[model samples]
Each structure stands twice: as structure tokens, then as C-alpha cells.
Target: MSININSKLDSQNSFWDINLEGELDVSTADKLKEYLHGLVEQEVVDMKINLSSLEYIDSTGLGVMIGVLKKLRTNDKEIYIINPKSNVKKIFTITGLDKIFKVEG
Candidate 1:
């Protein structure tokens, strides 16, 4: 029903370490978009998102990620998805997003 985002910035590496927990559907997608956008505005840096604890995600959540990826690409930065649950990983694969973003174990 809700999503929990825990994020930290690694200043030395100039990237974000973000962890997602709970469901990421229409209800929660906007929050993530806003958070990521705020970070993007501050600096264009790579983001590594850990999805091991994420229970679910819908199209809207995927859209938010795509949008952020697009923004980051302009600066030659990228988003790395780390440790996604099998179901979530399947969605990315089916949507052809896995090829676009770096999906690491």
C-alpha cells in the first residue's frame, strides 16, 4: 500500500545509495518521483537502487524510474537496479527496461 525509501549519498563517489521497501504502485510512485527529481536537481549522479525488500511495483512506479533514467542520461549518468526480487526483475525484463538500465545482482 505504501513504499519506504531509504537513501544515502556517497559524496566521495557522487552517487546515491537508495533502498526501496514495500509496494510501489500508483499510490506510491509520485513520492519516489519527487524524491528522485529533488536529487537530480541537486546533482546529476548515478543512483543505485536496491529492491530486495520491495514487495511489488506497478507501471506507474516503472514510469518514475524511466523518467529518472532519461534525466540522468542527459548527463551521461545512469541508474543501477540491485538485487530486485524475481517478480520485479521479470517486470523489468518484460518491459525491456532491463536492457536500458543496468540490473545487477
Candidate 2:
């Protein structure tokens, strides 16, 4: 019985640093999509996601990220994942997404 919490913070409306807490599974990935899908209209340059507080992520969550990336690519936007936990980082590494996305602490 894990309850996933999704939240975000905007930096000058130019950068979006989304923070994830708890689990991000099939049941909760859509919440993230809904939060991020409307960013196409923003004049954004960087989309930084703060993963410091993120506990877990699933394939569905990763899919959500890929979808967001596709949308951003059309606008020539950039995205980064920040401070992902070790276990979570393993997922990115195992899935080979760390190379595709700029992940930094």
C-alpha cells in the first residue's frame, strides 16, 4: 500500500524542476503526465527534474519521461534529472537512460 506523491516547483517559469516522492508505477504515472503535458506552451529552455526526493520509478514512469522528452525535443528544449537515489539510479543505468538524459546531483 504505497501512496505516491507528485509535486513540482517552477524556477522563474523558465525552468521546471519536478520533484517526485514515493513510488511511480503504472497506477501513478499518469499523474506525472498530466502535470507535465501542458509545458509545450511555455518558453522554457531547460527542464530539470529534481530526483533527490524520489523513492522509486517504474517503466511506466520512464515512459512518461520519454513522452515528455519527445514533446520537448520538438521545441528544442533540454531536460535533466537531478540527484536520483542510488537504487533509482540503478534503474536508469540498467535501462540505459542515464546516457540519454543528463543526470546530475
Candidate 3:
């Protein structure tokens, strides 16, 4: 399955909420990287990625997220990941990424 990213700015909270669906694998990792990098470049302070609808993810996808978090940290920004499915959550936990990034319910 292909990955799809839908995003919108929350004016009231001044944060960008990104909803990701479908699969996040090697092929789509670059797309995610570019999109997230653009947001960081634009000086977005807070980012919330909703992964509840995401059906699958690979190491590349996780790397893309980590790269984004690193970029944000450089700019003193923060990234929050929300509602990851159990399988996906396991990957984060195994990789110790759960401690590196904020995961919300």
C-alpha cells in the first residue's frame, strides 16, 4: 500500500497536525522526509503526527521520523506522535525510539 500524508495547520494551537495513512516503507520515506523538512524549514514550532490510521511501517519510515525529530531539535522545536497502532508501537519500543520521541495516546 502507498503512503498518504494529510496535513493542516491548527491556528488555535499554532501547531501542524499531520495525519498519515497506508504504508510507510522505503519507497515513501523520501516523500515523508521532504515534507517534514519543509515544515521545519518554515519554522514550524510544534508538530503532531497522528499515526492511528497507519497500517504499516518499515525501518526507513522510522528513520524518517527520527530525522525529522533531529531537525526539530536543532531549531528548538518539538514533535509529538499520537495513537500509534500496537504493531507500530512495538517497533518504536524495540528501537528505543519511544524514549526519544513523545508518544501520545
With a 3 Å backbone cut-off (N, CA, C), the pairs that clash in candidate 3 are: none
The backbone clash count of each candidate, in order, is 0, 0, 0
What residue runs in model 2 are displaced by over 4 Å at the alpha carbon?
Answer: 1-13
lDDT of 2 by residue, 1-105 (tens): 143444354656777766677777788888778777765455445688877777888899999989988888887877799899998899999999999889896
Ranking by lDDT: 1, 3, 2
**Pick by TM-score: 1 or 3, better one:** 1
Rank candidates by TM-score, best first.
1, 3, 2
Better of 2 and 3 by TM-score: 3
Model 3 TM-score relative to the real fold: 0.93
Model 2 — TM-score against the truth?
0.83
Q: For candidate 1, lDDT tens digit of each residue in 6-82?
A: 99899999899999999999999999999999988887899999999998989999999999999999999999999
Using lDDT as the measure, which candidate wins? 1
TM-scores of all predicted structures = 0.97, 0.83, 0.93
In candidate 1 the C-alpha lDDT for residue 32 amounts to 98
In candidate 1, residue 48 scores what lDDT? 97
